[model samples]
Target: MSSLLLRHHRPFLAFWFARVFTASGFQMITVAIGWQMYALTGNVLDLGLVGLIEFMPKILFILITGHVADRFDRRKVAALCQGAQGLIALGLLLGSGAGGISREMIFVIAFLLGTARAFEMPTTQALLPNIVPSNLFPAAVAASASAMQAATIVAPALGGLLYALGTHWVYGPAVVLYSCALSLMLSLPARQLPLKQKVSLESLLAGFRFIRSRPAVFGAISMDMCAVLLSGATALLPVFAKDILLTGPWGLGLLRSAPAVGALLMSLWLTRFPIERRVGPVLFTSVAIFGVATIGFGLSTSLWFSLAALVLLGAADMISMVIRSAFVQLQTPDEMRGRVGAVNGLFIGASNQLGDFRAGVSAAWFGTVPAVMIGGVGALVVTGLWIRLFPELAKRDHMHPQPNPQPPSAAA
Candidate 1:
């Protein structure tokens, strides 16, 4: 059982460590940026606009980036992107230190950083399958994803503390962390997938056509997108941290991390027992739980109660993520993984930034409390509607993916 997780998966372990470090440092950068922006402008709109500018370029370029991933060496691509991001971090450090931390500079840095992520996310995701044999891909993905969620749990609190110390100093440490990630990438064994075709518009469109042809895949991605878009509580977090909950930066960090802590715990447990058998039903149920948790969170006044609600929301989200990731990876051929992963990344961007925009707009109209509550309810409604609309999702089952299954004793 332990072998199912560790000994046989050495390369994946390296990848996991690299990703965790990268993600944690990025989270720290995020807090530092938000804090700095608010300090500089004292405007909620500025905070909201940061997400917008970052997401725009990513959403625009993600599919093309995915095509590049499928057609090239994913690991090398990841390295190049990471290297670019490291340079950006250095640029940020210099600019901030030079006292050039203006709104325009922030937007420029955000856009450039987002462009780096646009390429980075898909290649990193597509690279996972080649690291482990096909049979172990699911386990590897779950474990790696758990590590990512764990970073979420760890980074924000650490980031808030570091940001509180000083934004300039926080970026310096983040630069070190990004450099460490780059070194790890450089050390990785070369992982390249067979190229079916040169990267082109036709190839990219074909990838979308492939997704459109598969009802299960399409349904899963669509459902997740809508659910996340509706229940995006992260957008309103700074508001809660500052105004509503009155907990300030420390409270803000804890609140941001609570869901991820729940997700990390859930993903860790899932590695031991696969959630493959009833993936369709599981996804729906998990999403429903996510909605309920969000609603509860919106209604709660006490800090502890709100934290608990977000934690439950995170655990439920993990359930959907494990199944969806495994399903997408299993079904996609290596030649197309990058494109598919890119599409998945686009939905993620939509869920995160567009969702934040939605939350911000709604809050502007209905007040923060009502906006969150409505979004939670909207998530619940979307889940049910998708289940009804996408019957294929309801019928999904994990068939024997390989010719021979290890008996339960031998199973990961």
Candidate 2:
């Protein structure tokens, strides 16, 4: 452990462990969901609908959720959300044990899970700055990202293995893990913020207005949204696992873990040697590499080749993610963290869910390979377009927070 992580940051360490348990369980559930749904329907579009069902509540309730995080105790809110997710997992366990799990039941559960995530993500993100010193915040973000990648790397394999035993096995451990996460979240030191005196439409929309006013923040987030929205391939992993690569559930597990494996490596590297110069160009270059790697994965028939491509894809994305996360959180004021995080969460939710929908529809219309390949091309093109559209983002030279160059009035 880095001395930075171990010393003077016991609360942050607890938070990181909470992330591990929560993220591990979530990733495990993801594998179970994708495999079970595909097995039940064997339809690509159905897989896409999985993401859509989960995304709906997130999109609809995001703004309110952000306000709730800001107005209330973020730790308590996160604990409640984590507890709800645990109950949902328990529901899945019971359903699987009864052998009564249906496609509709799965979709309903996914929606409930998405609702929990909607409240949890923004609150959890906003809570970090309160947990660590400002000088160490960037390092904390890197460590946090690394921790998440570690969970991603481990959880899928565990999920796949347990799923191979039985569906109930997957949810059982998930329920336990989520319970642990809730406990850890509750143990974190409470953060006290001034309560909002009044609630109004304008207050709810402050995060939106703030993000819109910050060009660098807006550009980074927009670029990420477009690139990932176009090239998200995780939702379609089952298609590749069973049909394209002819690998079984275990292969699916390895495939899912490969990207995170690369990401974990990159995150650790960043913690040791942070990106200090040409931050904007690094972001753009990393995204472009992500596009090319996606194309490579789309074209590969061999499992090894696909895994290699995915590793590159994940490594590139980690760079982009670290930079973007640090930029958004470091720049935003403490009171506005929840709202800003909500906006960031919305972009992420859109890219992930809508991206899956696009891939499913495209796979249905053209073909899997063509759909993925075309999306990769779109990602590359978006990278170029974003460079042109957000010149200030490209000109940005460092990750440290900078004074706003333009007045709030200049926002359109």
Candidate 3:
């Protein structure tokens, strides 16, 4: 299994390590931002705004970023983005050290960081296919997902501990990690595709057109987007940690890490026993399970119970994430990968950041518990609706790219 996953793939391994370091640092920064923002404002809505601030750049420049990723060297783009993120971390560190860091300053830093991410996400995603053999793509995806989950598992706990010391402590190490990721990215073999002769509005929008013409890709991305948008409980974790469960920063770390722990375990399992059939049903079932787990998490006041629910949620989400990633990467043509990835990133950014914003506003309108519970119910409703609306997705039996059963006209 190990050989199948990582044998003779040094560049891929480097990419994986880069992911680990980058993800860990980013996760640490995330924890510090959340805790410090909540500390400063004592407002749950501010926590949600953190995501919103980060998301705005992606909304603004994702298309251009994706086009750049396709037109230039993806590795260099990623390296440049990593360097930008490292600078942002340094900025955060300096601001924290200078004392009296304002909420607005934090928001500004978040926007800059999000800007770096907007470029980094599509470039990094598009680089994956270029790094490894086509036949080993699934294994590579599984391994990459596992590495990310592992980072998520460790980073939050580490960040929480570092945050307990000082917010600057979190930023300082994050700077180092981001620098390391930049170095690794710089070292990767360059694979720049030839640029198109002419740029047009149609070329820029081709990814959208492709997805619209392929129901499976459309269904998968839309389902994950809606489910996650409704069910996401991550943004409200600090509220639960401080007010509901009364766990404190340390407890918040554990709460944040719980889902990743489950995800890591599931990713490891998938690496060993790759899902070969009925992938659509697996995706739907996992999402439904994720919704149920979110409901349980929303209702739980106890730390242990909440952790269990989050773990289940993570496990289920892992399945959907792996399947969806494979679908997007495998199904799309290489020339269009970056643009498609950008669109996918947009969906992800909207779901995660906007979901946090939604949670925050809802928590402000209703109580925290009610907001989370309602979101969970909304996820369940989305799952049912998606299944009914996109029955072909449920019938999708394999992960490998296949001929579309529906004609383009029917898909539209």
Q: Considering TM-score, where higher is better, how would the candidates rank from best to worst?
A: 2, 3, 1
Give the per-residue lDDT of model 3 (tens digit) for 1-412: 2475566888898899999999999999888889889989989898889888999998898668778888898998999999998998898899889885799988888899899999889889999988888888877888888889999999998999889988888999999999999999888887666667467788888778877888888898888889888878788999999999987788888899999999999999888888999998999999999999999999998999999999999999999888888778877877788889998999899889889988998899997999989888988898889999999888778787567696567654
Best by lDDT: 2
Q: Could you tell me the TM-score of candidate 2?
A: 0.96
Tens-place lDDT per residue, model 2, 1-412, is: 4676678889999999999999998988989988999999999988888888888887899779888888899989999999999998899889888888889998998899999999999999999888888788877887888899999999998899889999888999999999999998888987657555478888888889998988888898889889989998888899999999998888899999999999999999988898999999999999999999999999999999999999999999989888888778777888888888888999989888888988888888888999899989999999999999999898889787567797567656
Give, for candidate 3, the lowest lDDT window spanning 10 residues. Answer: 1-10
Per-candidate alpha-carbon RMSD to the true structure: 4.8, 4.4, 4.3
Off by over 4 Å in 2: 401-412
Tell me which of candidates 2 and 3 scores higher on lDDT. Answer: 2
What is the C-alpha lDDT profile of model 1 across 183-288, one tens digit per residue?
7876767757588686567887766787788788788888888998888878678787777777777787888899998998898888776675867888898898
Worst 10 residues of 2 by lDDT: 190-199
- Model 1: runs farther than 4 Å from truth? 1-5, 397-412
Error of 3 at 295 (Å): 0.9
For model 2, state the Cα shift of residue 68 in Å. Answer: 0.8
Distance (Å) between predicted and true CA of 215, model 3?
Answer: 0.4
Better TM-score candidate (1, 2): 2
